[model samples]
Target: MNYDQLMFNINAYKENNQILDLAKFLVYEFELDHPNLEGFGFRDELEKNSILLTANGDIGERQMVLIPRNLFDFEFNLVINMIAHEMLHVRQKSPEMMLEDKNEREWQAYYEMLFHTNFPNVPDVSDYHKKFFAEKALEYYRRMGEGSELQAKYADQKLKVLSLIDNIQHNQA
Candidate 1:
């Protein structure tokens, strides 16, 4: 999609009091297909810095993306990227799955958040943010070295994350 067109459309949604529509549009545009993908809306109680998509841990519950009520405080692009990050979490769940490694989940989510083409604008991923991601990447790397089949399977992603970390560390701004 064209960056200018996307931004203009998002702004229109923002002005029309249809931010939830914007979120739904993003979910569809991102092609986040899941039977449990309920819908998107705001939550007053959600913390300011977080946009979360939650899966129902119990039966009969549903999955939904909860945006902060103070949505106007965040940049539209960043907010979309954050929602995409949470939706990535939504896509990771299963009906009866084992607890997955937190580092692995986070690294994968972060990779998609920063690199996905559906998001035309990438907000500044701060040095602090990179450090946090680097720790997760290193832990995943450690798991790979220890012969974790699951981690080993993501070796290509591991290398990419480490390469990004290396590039950023050496070329500090």
Candidate 2:
């Protein structure tokens, strides 16, 4: 589907006037440079608990991102965060860069997200959210099976991302 259709779905899922406004704000925030980029919406049953941002190949071709509808049920800020995070991934795809450095790639995306958005100033991330991400990563690993090296790679990347988030929060404090 197109970006507008995807946005409509997200807006429909929003629960309140404040959330609608937040969603609008996020859309405006993303639109500042988003028109030049190529993006499409795809349903991700597997990633129902998480959002993903991926860029394939150089020349900045093949940009794809998915956001979970369930996340919209949590907080409007989260929806904005997920979308913004994925947009950063779209920006990171370089034709010259090798794809093997998964952790490095994720670190770059996380840094981009932090740099682009006004992340909340909370010193410590809630245990609930931490456990949620951990569990989501574990579930992904299980689905990928032990034979898949990608699963292990993702796990390592996830750990690094979590650590980076912690560092950002600590530094902010």
Off by over 4 Å in 1: 45-62, 95-103, 117-149
Among the numbered candidates, top lDDT falls to: 1
Error of 1 at 23 (Å): 0.7
Residue 24 in model 1: shift from native, Å?
0.4
Please give, for residues 1-173, the per-residue lDDT of candidate 1 as tens digits. 77788778777887888877877776666565456567776666467675444433333334676776556557665565667666666665544432366556566677775456434444545665665655655665575447777677777776777787777888885
Model 2 Cα lDDT, one tens digit per residue, 7-67: 6766664655344344334555456224323543445445555544344334346454544
Clashes of 2: 1
Q: In model 2, what is the error at residue 140, expressed in angstroms?
A: 16
Candidate 2 structure, TM-score to reference: 0.44
Best by TM-score: 1
List the RMSD of every prediction in angstroms. 4.4, 9.4
